[model samples]
Target: MKTYLPSTSYEYATVQKVAGTTITEASDVLAAEEPLEIRLGYGPAGQRQHRTLSITMRTPGHDFELTAGFLLTEGIIRSRADLTGILYCPDVAKDEERENVVRAELVPGLSLDLPRLERHFYTSSSCGVCGKTSIDAVHATSCPVLPTDGPYLDVAVVHELPARQRAAQALFEQTGGLHAAALFSPAGELLLLREDVGRHNALDKVIGAALLAEWLPLHQHVLLVSGRASFELVQKAAVAGIPIMAAVGAPSSLAVQAATNFGMTLLGFVRQQRYNVYCHGWRLVNQQPAGGPDKVA
Candidate 1:
C-alpha cells in the first residue's frame, strides 16, 4: 500500500518493541494535499487568451482531466470537442508545485459567462459539495437520460466493485481518510480509480481521465464511489453520461431525486453482497425473481 502525505504534515515513525528493549521503526504515510489552479484560455481567429478560472485544492495526479471534467460537469463546457487543450503550467518554478496547477484551453469562440463564474475562484477538497448555492443549479444542467442501449452489468459484476476499488485505493490505504471514485466497465471491471480527501475531486479525476481518453458519453460504464452518494456526485456522473452509479455509503435526498430525474440507476450501501436500489431499479438485474431487468430502449 502507498501513502498520501498532506502538504503541511510531517511524517514520523512508530517504534515497535517490548518493554525496555530496542525496536524497529515503521514509516508513516502522510496525506497528499495541494492546490490545483484550473485556468482557462479562449480566443478567436486561431489565437488564444488565457484567464485564471478557478483553483481547487486537491490531491496530486490527473490535474488535466480534473480541470476538463470540472468544467464539463459544472456546465462551463459541453463536450470534449469544446476543449482545444489541457496542460500543466511549465512556468511554475517549483517542481512539486508545477504538477498542482493546470490550464484548459477552450475551443476558439468559447468563453464562460461572467455571472456563472464564482467571485472567489478557489475551492478546497473539504468543501466542494457545501459550496453550492442551491440544488436547482445542479438540476438545471443535468444531462439528458442516455440512450437505453447503454451497457448492463450482472449482479455478480456489481458485487465485485468494492473489493476492486479497495485494491486500487493506494492513497486511502495509507491515509485511511480519502474518498475514492472508480470507473468500471459494464462487465464490472475496474477501469480507473482515484482517491482524494474530497469525494467530488476523486470523481472529477476519473471523469477527467475518461475525457482525456476520448471516452465521452460514459454510458458504456458505471461509476462507483467509496463514500456516500451526494447530489453533486450524481450531477457529475450524469454530466459525464454514466448511466449507472453505486456508492458504498448512503445516498442523500437530492442524489436520489437527481438520479431518478436523469434516468440513472442509483445504488447505495453496497457491501457484503447486498445493496439498496434507490432510483431506476430497472437497471439492476436479478434483483427480483419475478422477471429480468427492465428494458428501456
Candidate 2:
C-alpha cells in the first residue's frame, strides 16, 4: 500500500459455514478506501497556475497515471510532452486527507477551455456518452483512427483469457465485490491487471499504469474485463488505441456500437471454453485442420 495514512475502515471478508450452506461475511478488517483529488496546472512561468480538477474515489497507489490517463481521455493533453510533472502537494503529509490530493503540472502554453471541459464531465470512463445534442459532437472528440495493421491474436489465445483474468483478481478473490480489468498480449500473456469497486475505476487504473510507462497507443495489446463490457470501457480502450477487447460478461448495445464505430474488435461472454465475438470476427485466425481449406476460427 502507499502508506500515506488511512481514514475510513475497510472490512475484508471471511467465509463461514452456516448450517448447510457456505456464506461469506466481513470480519478481518483492512485499510480504508482513499479518495484522491486530481489537480491540473498550466500557463506561463511567472504566473504558473493550478486548478482542482476532480476528486475521484480511488486507492492512492497509482495517482500519477490516473492523472495522465484522465487528461489523455479527456482530450486535454494528447501526448506526454504536454505534461511537465505530476506530484503530490508539498503539504500533503500535514493534511489529514493526504491520500485525497495530488497535482499535475502542465507545460507552458497548454491552454484549456473550462467551459468545454465542463461539458465533457458527463463523458468519462465511468459514464457513457449519451448527453450529446447531436452526432457531430461525438465526431468532434471521438477516438482517433487507430492503426489498422495492429497485432493480431489467435482464437485459441482468446479462449484462455477468462481463466487468466480470474487468476489475476486477488482483491475480487477476497471481497467478491470488486471488478477487474486486465491487459494481455496477442499471444495471451498477461501484462497488467487492476481491481476496483467500480468497473470504470479498474479500467482507469490500467490506462493510468500504461500512461505512466509511456505506453499510450497500446495497439499491440488486448484488454480484458472481469465483468460486463460497458460503453465507457470500450471508449477508454479506443482512446488508448487498444484494438481488441474481451469480457467475461455480456456487452451492452452501446459498447458493441462503439466498437463497430472504432473498427475495434469486441468480445463478450468469454467463459472457460466459449465466447461470443460481438464485432470484428475477421481478426480470429483460421482453425481449420491441416488438410482442409481456409475456415473461420
Candidate 3:
C-alpha cells in the first residue's frame, strides 16, 4: 500500500460580502469539490486486470475510505479481506491526476460477478431503476435485516446528537458547504465522523473507515446525518448493519419504506428538543406515543 496523504478539504475564494449598504471583498472558504475515480485491480497475481469502477464528485479528503465504503455498500466487495491494497494511482504522470484516482486491488483470483456490477452501474448512471427495483436490489445483496434485540437509544441522547455533530464539524464550520455523517454509541458518545460535499460520500467515508478498521456490522451504534435521510443513505446504513439512523432534515417517503422493510429505526428532523420517529419506534426509550391516525396501507 502506498502512503496515503490527506487532501485539501477546503479552498480559498474571493467573495463580495454585502452587509446593509456596504460591500467588501473578502477571502472565503469553500468546500473543495473534485472528481475521484475509483479503479479496481483484480485477476491473477502476475496478470492483473484493472478497471475504472466509478467517478464521483466529492470533497477531496478521505479518498481511500470513500472508495472502500463505496465498494462495500454497492455490494462489490463484502469485507476488508477482499481488498489486497488501496493506493493512489502511481502510474499517472501528473501529481494532481494521481491523487484524484484511486485503485483498490482485490485479492488474487477472487470471484467477482461482473455482469451484476455492470448492471448496477448502468442502472444508477441512467436513473432507470425504479423504487421497487432499487429496494429489491438491496435485498439481493448480503445486507442483513437489522436486529431488534438491543442497542436501544434514549430520546435525550437522540436530541443531543445534532448539536454534537455540529460542534465537531470542523470542515463544515469553515466552508458551511459540507455534509457530515457520524456514528455514536447508544449513550450518545460520538465515535467516528466523516465530512464531504456529498452526503452519500460522507457516509461512505465513515463506513469505509469502519470497514477498514474491521469494525463493520455496526449493529450496536446509532448513525446520524447532517442532512435529510435518503434511500441511498438508509441503504448504506442497512448494509453496514446499523440499527438506528437519525437525520437533521426530513426523510423521503422511500427512505422510510426502506428503513421499515429492513427493521431499522429511522428518525427525522432530529433538532431542537424533539424528532419524528418514522418506523420501529420501539427501540427508542422515554418516548411518548404519537397518537396519530392509523398507518396508511
Task: Write down the lDDT that model 3 would get.
Answer: 0.89
| Candidate with best lDDT | 3
163-272 per-residue lDDT for model 1 (tens digits): 99998887677667788999999787888888777798889989988887889888888899999998889989988889999999999987888788778888998888
Question: Residue-wise lDDT of candidate 3 within 1-297, one digit each (tens)?
Answer: 342224477778999999999999999988899899999999998999999888999998889999999999998889999999899998976777868999999999688888888887988888845687788889887687788797899887887999999988888887799899999999999999999999999999999999999998998999999999999999999999999999999999999999999899999988887688899988988765556342211
Q: How does each model score on TM-score? A: 0.81, 0.82, 0.94
Report each candidate's C-alpha RMSD, comma-separated, in the order given: 5.4, 4.7, 4.2
Pick by TM-score: which candidate is best? 3
lDDT against the true structure, each candidate: 0.77, 0.75, 0.89
Error of 1 at 9 (Å): 13
* Residue-level lDDT for 278 in candidate 3: 93
- TM-score comparison, 1 vs 2, better candidate: 2
* Model 3 per-residue lDDT at 60: 89
Candidate 3 TM-score over all chains jointly: 0.94
Higher-scoring candidate on lDDT, 2 or 3: 3
Q: Which scores better on TM-score, 1 or 3?
A: 3
Which ten residues in a row are the worst by lDDT in model 2? 1-10
**Candidate 1: misplaced stretches above 4 Å?**
1-26, 45-48, 91-97, 119-142, 289-297
Candidate 2 lDDT, 142-196, residue by residue in tens: 4666657757778789889888888776655654667788999999999998766
Candidate 3 lDDT at 140 equals: 84
